[model samples]
Target: MTYTALNKQVQSPLTEQDKRIIATIIQRHADEIKTLWIDCGITVWVQLQDGGRLAFDRNWFAQRVAEEKTSLEAQENLHRQNQRLEAELKQACTEYGLQHGEIDYLMFSTKVYRGRDLVGFVGFHRFSQMWTYSRRATEPDRYARSASDALAKLGVRQLTMV
Candidate 1:
């Protein structure tokens, strides 16, 4: 049945069990609930301090619980992958004798280093939708290429040395 049509069936007020289920779903899927509501045209209302009532679609709540579970699973998988990449990056840095400071800056900050020395800074070029490493325009390409390769192993992509 359509949601609009089902909305008129106020005779069957939500039971205590239904309220419990809804509360559980909301707590478990707080992150995905907003997008789910917009996508499914689900409405939610809450009672104010004075006197009012809250309404929402039970079907939508159920669907959101399922979808949020799937979404959270995917996110967990991605997080695992990222963790693996981070470990690999750490090992690579150790083997290459690269300083941890350089790695940290590359991963977390916009500062760019030239062979263990901070040469310049990097910025995202909005027009090109790519990162621009600014400094040492005449330097050999090998250093930049090596740095890019290291970052690539850490799941960083589309970095421009220029």
Candidate 2:
């Protein structure tokens, strides 16, 4: 089956406090790689309606640094490997494999709430790498079979796919 993302259950621009919190979250994530995927550079925390902004600050213009500095040949090889893996996935699940126009940025959507009211939105984050693959989300559905019961303990209703 295909995935459909959720629109906001509430509407309004983020309050100053919300902005500050988001900023702090970004600053905190930069140095301390918490959760690897959820709070890292690749994990973009975009709001739902009309699209949104990053929860973390991405250095819009940063020269290649230490670990990230790679030669062109290595980059090309990685690109080819990713392409091969993507083709394999498409062949495995043809129906959901083709994303017409969507960027299909790897992500997961979680309800945002403040004082029991839905407010902050959870966004799609990377599982690993900065890969821009869509079908990757199917992995979460597989996890849901076990995660749902545990999430229910945290008061979550269900694990929705995107």
Candidate 3:
């Protein structure tokens, strides 16, 4: 089965306080090495290179960072894995023919590599009320999965033909 993302259950723009909090979250993530993918409502998805998804509560993120800091080796390995995962994530997006606008929300999927060779991945998908619809959202099943399906078939075709 394939993944289908969710749209907003309500229509609402972010409040001033919400913007501030969002900005802080963005800024904090921006300073780090993590990459962030943002899905605004069900209408727009933007991949931010400077920051990872900011959908988490501030304290939770802080706690994670603190825990990570306790082990220097782990932190280094994690950073390496993040770098590899960033590339693989981009590749998956391309291979699957997914546009940045198609994502419903942010997912922090980590990729691991060994000596420039990618190994595996893990992901954190955030489902929260952070974005408003910039435009009316189309039905989630309508368009998003088509590209992924087509791409998969295309891959099989190429492999078989080769």
Quote each prediction's TM-score. 0.36, 0.21, 0.23
- Candidate 3's C-alpha runs over 4 A off are 1-70, 100-107, 110-162
Cα TM-score of candidate 2 = 0.21
Q: How close is candidate 1 to the true structure, as a TM-score?
A: 0.36
* Model 2, C-alpha of 108: deviation from truth (Å): 14
- lDDT by residue (tens digit), candidate 1, 111-144: 4433567544333233343434444444322222
lDDT of 1 at 56: 60
lDDT scores for all predictions? Answer: 0.43, 0.34, 0.36
- Writing each residue's lDDT as its tens digit, candidate 3 over 1-162 gives 222323232324554443333345445332332232234433222223353333544455455545544664565766765555445445644553332322211343333233354332323222331111111123121111222232342231212222
Clashes of each: 0, 2, 1
Q: State, as a TM-score between 0 and 1, how close model 3 is to the true structure.
A: 0.23
- Which ten residues in a row are the worst by lDDT in model 3? 128-137
Weakest lDDT window of 10 consecutive positions for candidate 1? 29-38
